[model samples]
Target: MSRIGKKAVPVPAGVTAEIAGQAVNVKGPKGALSFVVHDLVAVDQSAEGIAVKPRDETKLARSLWGMSRTMIANLVTGVSKGFERKLEINGVGYKAALNGKVLTLSLGYSHDVLFPVPEGIVIQVLGAKSDQIIVSGIDKQQVGQVAAEIREWRGPEPYKGKGVKYAEEKIFRKEGKKK
Candidate 1:
């Protein structure tokens, strides 16, 4: 038995769930989210919570059963509470700014790098430090993907530790060679 799949997902107040064909739709105060279940997985809704089950004991079905439950739970929670990620820029002269929907990043390049923000995702420049950035959205996957793309522009270097990184992430610094 899959522990995660067997667990019940609690339905918060004011949230409604509907099953239509192979799709499950959840609507809450914040927004609405929907997902389609695979053929080997089944979803059942009750007054207390929702349950996800696998049609067979095969390895693939077991894995999909657990993953489907978690994804559904995330969708329900995302539309209700949303998700956010914080990023910090390192190195001198490295900074970030938001102009409309574009993110202007100065990462020691001769010219500023402009990144267009995706729809439904909001980017905000926080604090006078000029290095802090906050990305927020109702979809968790999109928020994480955008953050990763921004970090890829200047991935942390082992020697100088110059790049964009998570606010609390730690990077190991290499020691300089003796002359």
Candidate 2:
């Protein structure tokens, strides 16, 4: 019943996929990743591509069908190309610097905030002014989580729109004092 579930996931040319029972392992140019499919859904690989379907007609099985298929797709994409997220800091004295595995942030605070980078992820500070930060990893979820954690230290304010925010994010500025 799910459109996304019915669609087969085509494995790219450079990627290798191995299915062992409910676990699927994928290896590609970027890296290797693995995921376990839920029991409610079934996975099959054919000459055409990888197919996912519900094991039964029950509601839970149907709900997991699409989700399982998407998970496999994500795994393939992640190992093949990896993922990256970019954030920009706005405001005077707001910048980021990378020292070894530590990221130092100056966001108008009296003291600099030091963040330790995690394994399997790379954080780079770009821009001549140090306003740009790039987070990259083979795992899409890990890349997003690291980026969100860095942004959480100083989110953009509605009034001034000054803070760390996604590179493509747009902040809705609020009107200042009406006096």
Candidate 3:
């Protein structure tokens, strides 16, 4: 019995969740989202909220129990409040700008790196130096994937610690060479 799976996910106000077959559809003020649950886990809704349980005591079923529950929770939260990922660009000439649906980055490259923004995701460039980017979307997976792709362009280096990094991320700075 997984602790997280055993707990019921409460449906918030102004949000509706429907469990149909192996899929769960969630709709809220922000947007609508759906998730197809695996057969290993059983999902049902009660007056209190949604409940998830493993079909059997098998190892695979138990492993997916908590994960399925968490995925459902993410759908609910995402439809209601959405998700956001913030990235900070560090370097002398590193910066970012949003042009319509395109995100242009300057990471000491010879030419500006143009990143085409995908649908359902909004990219906003902020900060006084225009080095901060905020990626927001109703889907958690898409938001995270887009953020990761952007970070891959110019990952933070261990030496100077200059590159793209999460707002809450801490880069380990290595000591300089002793002459």
Candidate 4:
């Protein structure tokens, strides 16, 4: 049995759920998200909430059942409440700004790097210093992928600790060799 799959997914009052063949469509105040049900996993709408069941007790099937249900639930919630990721610029002179739909980053480079923000993703600069960037979107995967790509532009250096990083991410500094 899958613990996560057994959990009931609560449906908000304004949200509407529809089952179309193997696809499930969830419509909420934010938007509508549809997902295809897997063969090993079965989804059913109940008066209380949505329930997911696995066809077999095998390890792979059980895991997939739970993960698929969780992913579907996340999609519903994301379309309703949305998701956001924050990245901090650690080095001096490193900053970010939004020019229309383009994100301009200055990561101690000779030239400022300007990247166009993808559709459905919003970029915002926090504080007057502009050292903080907030990426918000309805899709969790897209938001994370965008953040990762931005971070890759100027990944944190082990020696100088320069570049973009998550707010809670820790950087390990190496000790200098004795002269």
Best model number under TM-score: 3
On TM-score, the stronger of 1 and 2 is: 2
How many backbone overlaps does candidate 1 show? 0
Comparison by TM-score, 2 against 3, better one: 3
| Best of the two (2, 4) by TM-score | 2
Per-residue lDDT value at 174 in model 3:
94
Which ten contiguous residues of candidate 2 have the minimum total lDDT?
Answer: 41-50
Best by lDDT: 3
Least accurate stretch of 10 residues (summed lDDT) in model 1? 13-22
Q: Candidate 1 on 98-139: residue-level lDDT in tens?
A: 999899999988999999999989999987878999999888
| Candidate 1 ranges with C-alpha deviation above 4 Å | none
Q: Please give, for residues 131-151, the per-residue lDDT of candidate 3 as tens digits.
A: 999999999999999999999
Off by over 4 Å in 2: none
Of models 1 and 2, which has the larger lDDT?
Answer: 2
lDDT of 2 by residue, 59-153 (tens): 99999999889989999988888889999999998999999999999998889999999998999899989999999988888999999999999
Candidate ranking (lDDT, best to worst): 3, 2, 1, 4
**Model 3 poorest ten-residue lDDT run:** 1-10
As a whole number from 0 to 100, the lDDT of residue 11 in candidate 2 is: 96
TM-score of every candidate relative to the true structure: 0.95, 0.96, 0.98, 0.92
Clashing pairs in 1: none
